[model samples]
Target: MNIIGGPAQDGEWPWQIALMWNNIYVCSAALLTPDWAVTTAQCVNQEASGYSILIGTNNLAEWSPNYQRQPVASVYKHPEYNTRIHDFDVALLRLTDPVEITDYSRTICIPTTDMSFEVGTTCYASGWGSSDGINEFLQEAQFSITSSNNCEGVTSNMLCADGIESSGACAGDEGGPLVSLVDTRWYLVGLTSKTTCGSGADVFTRMTAMYEWIAPILDGETPLSK
Candidate 1:
């Protein structure tokens, strides 16, 4: 069994969102705007038509039972996203209606053009990924620091993060948030794109490289993040 960190404690950035489909649930997503969410393109790639965005809840158990279920109005996959190379695997989803950001549903701060994370620098990742190597249908959030490098042999856009011990994202944790604390505020540096499906380094799509593409969408100036 894969042993990992404990679930997210109360009141630590409660703006996370849970993406649900059928019996498969992925703790992958972060609220980017009142009407938009930042996650992995692959999360919506196969079944874009059937996914629902559950917002306004830190507690996954209460998500479906208590929170509002918003239909995905549109999905914007990066034009260059290639599953083969895993390049540009980032995507944004526009909700049919704007979700009111409460204490439990706030928009995450995106990094400014000047901010950049380096290798060996510590960052935090949270999601309803697996715990104890057991895959549950429910979602649970855990934390992990950034890895040493952003996939050294792989492409530059891929960011890496290792668990402090046996803690990290797993198979069902894709399309979540890989955040970095800069100047006391947490910036959405990466989107949890993929991992090895067990206790291993989790990969994310670097937000820095995709700023230009994502900016217009967040600002409502463009219909897509491409």
Candidate 2:
């Protein structure tokens, strides 16, 4: 996650999640529902016995009263996810316990409608990773939707964004959320799939393109899931 930006305040991005592997912060995630979180399949594939989720706090160095750490009950990587190219890069995480709703912990809306996050729409990408070193607190940067054509390897299932000049940072932003505000509510429009960190050409798994694969998983428990 390339988080070359300012530290985020508590509750600024409540849906944000800190993905843990062996108790160490690895990548970021988004709370999809009280019981479910969303991240990249790449992140899931790196899982080990210590997999867990850290919610309700912006800082990872300290465990506060609002902090809640839950073990991951299960992981569901998309069936069509491609490790070679990272296509269909999302994965759903089932938490052992539902995260209690609070100002510091909540879920964000995912794109599931016949809509497009048109070019030029402003969006924000947040994470706790560093471009140079690990950050103790969450950080964020703003980006503007750019034509996918600007970046090579852009695919039909991806959307591209260019970081604003004065901002943008990255250390290990894998599986972070790229969200946009629409009519007062923030929607998760993309997942950090790929990036050329320094120049800010981010390639994200466009959530809209995965509605078919995601809608079903979100509606009811699938009979068979990874």
Candidate 3:
């Protein structure tokens, strides 16, 4: 958690990944497939450099059997991403190779249809961001999807959530997931895009809106021959 929150329990968010640049945590990302992940463009618009992903671990300070770090092979940012306003803030990272899927590492299920979560829908936000730069454990919080009409700076394509003052994603939490539990399964609906910590509601890029650009790439990849 950033401004306010607690650490997530191990195995709580198996789909979570840490995106790092030159070994420093930059933002959080969601594993969509063994070889592909999604994050915010703001985290990757900079000049290409050494980028890697940490998977299958909740604790970042120490290593475990579940921990696996893989280098990024390529970056694909949404073409319409408006860097000025952080609109359409989404990006995809291709891994050098597919990661091993285990009990502690898994892919998140994304919505297939153009579904909209109504206001007050409960969703979970998870990341590893902190202001003091001391938090090493993954953090998460429960937030309800709200209307962006009153949230200043929020756009139509972004999903807004309330209670960010008391609980929500923090710095370094950028590009992490805002997921909704549907039918006993978690569905990624948004990405932590922008926020003011305790001052205002947090905003996340609606994942469904990016489906058109993401689906094609995901569909083209076949599972590695085991």
Candidate 4:
């Protein structure tokens, strides 16, 4: 039943993450707490000392005892986050320990309100990035929520969807995830940040306008400056 953009079915996204860096993988993160995670700050490039975070797995080549890697201890970013114009692209890693959630690892659902989800509202976008590279699994699509005036440097915290051409989420799909099921659960409203895979409109970075900089860094407390 994973249609719209396609390809994803074994365990269907358990908060999909894989941001490794020296072991490769390079981008796509979302497991909110087995030690926090939420990505895109230009994919936190280098220096969290070895970076890591594989977790559960939809096939990073296939291994699964529910995969699970771990190894990054700190890397917040969102002090305005304007890598050029991507504005608040979001970022938060912290996980040198805690990693073993159960039903195949989990955590996702951060939109305590700030609204915005009308235009068309279909949502659901996972990633393992593909343009002919990674992606042996983990890759859902089905976007819809459109009308940031149709993209073109979207703003207003940003959150546009609309996909088509070669599908969507490309180039290692930076900081993946863009969910939205609302009402039945599942809501991590956008994070793939920036795209033009073809049919236009992709931007994202409006997890309820950064929920006051992510609920005190998910309760470890202390976020509220800027």
- The prediction achieving the highest lDDT against the true structure is 2
Error of 3 at 220 (Å): 1.3
Global Cα lDDT for candidate 3: 0.81
**Each candidate: RMSD to true structure?**
3.3, 1.9, 3.9, 14.7
- Tens digit of per-residue lDDT, candidate 3, span 1-226: 3735577777788999988889888889999999898899998954446999998888778855788889998888888889888888988888899989998889998777567788999888888777666367888777888878747777766888865447756677789988899988999989988865645678899888878778876777522110
Note the residue pairs that clash in candidate 4. none
Candidate 2 C-alpha lDDT tens digits along 1-226: 4565578888998998999988888888999888888898888763435789998898888865787788898887888788888888888888888999998898999887587799999999988766676678888889888998876788888888888874553657888999999998899999988867656578888998877776765776641344
TM-score of each: 0.82, 0.93, 0.92, 0.34
Tens digits of per-residue lDDT for model 4, 38-112: 888888853588888887877788758767788897777878888898788888888889878777778887886
What C-alpha lDDT, on a 0 to 100 scale, does residue 180 get in candidate 4? 81
lDDT of 1 by residue, 126-198 (tens): 6666544334333333444455453433466777776565566666567877777777777887877666544
Model 3 residue runs over 4 Å out of place are 1-5, 46-48, 221-226
Please give the CA lDDT of all the candidate structures. Answer: 0.67, 0.82, 0.81, 0.78
* lDDT, residue 112, model 1: 62
Range of the 10 consecutive residues with the lowest summed lDDT in candidate 4: 1-10
Worst 10 residues of 1 by lDDT: 133-142
- TM-score of model number 3: 0.92
